[model samples]
Target: MRPLVYEQTRFSPRVIFDAGNGVFEMEGTLMLEDNKVFFQTINRWWRIYQQSPNPQTKIVCKLNYYTLATDNFLMQWLYVLKDIPNVELIWYYNPDDWEMQEYATTYQSNYSFVKLKEEKVR
Candidate 1:
């Protein structure tokens, strides 16, 4: 499948799908004004992913510092990965953020891919 390229805006997060590499990477400041439009893009790709479920799918949540409003709504995206039947998810976080470890159970879905490492938050 030719990957889907969802452009990024000042308020919108960047989403890039790599069908060949088996990677679906999304990175940017999370502060979208329109929830419907923002979530629709995610939901559409998720539907595609559901149909063409890869053996391994890396969902990168590399956010520098999302606002509290964004954090609250972030659960919507997380729920998308909650119980992916066969796809392995990668929820990589900066080890420096103490908040990551505190909320371990929040990401029980394919937990193995959830790695806390020392990396620059793109």
Candidate 2:
């Protein structure tokens, strides 16, 4: 399968899931009007990646902000990552952004299978 690339909009994040290089990155803000549709694309890409995954898969989440509506979909996506072997999630948040930090903590509590590390950014 080809790599999945979704450009970001004013209310959505950018997605770059490159299966060949084993680098999956989601950046910018996430506040989509139709989250189900957006998340479904991510779900499909993830399923395909699991077929023949890289020895070490890295997911970088650099979301600056997100709406409340996005929590469920984000949780579900993280849950799916739990089943994939050798997956690590790096959640980057602004040093002063407690909300994002809290979200990362929640993810850590829910998905123990995938290694999660938090990074403070500018």
Tens digits of lDDT, candidate 2, 35-97: 999999899889888888899888888888998899999998987788789888887777677
Off by over 4 Å in 2: 113-122
Which parts of model 1 have CA positions greater than 4 angstroms off? 95-105, 108-113
Candidate 1, residues 27-92: lDDT per residue as tens digits?
766676666666667766676777767776666666655555665455666667655665554555
For all predicted structures, in order, the TM-scores are 0.69, 0.90
Model 2 clash pairs are none
Indicate the residue-level lDDT of 9 in model 2.
81
lDDT of 2 at 33: 86
Q: Residue 29 in model 1: shift from native, Å?
A: 1.1
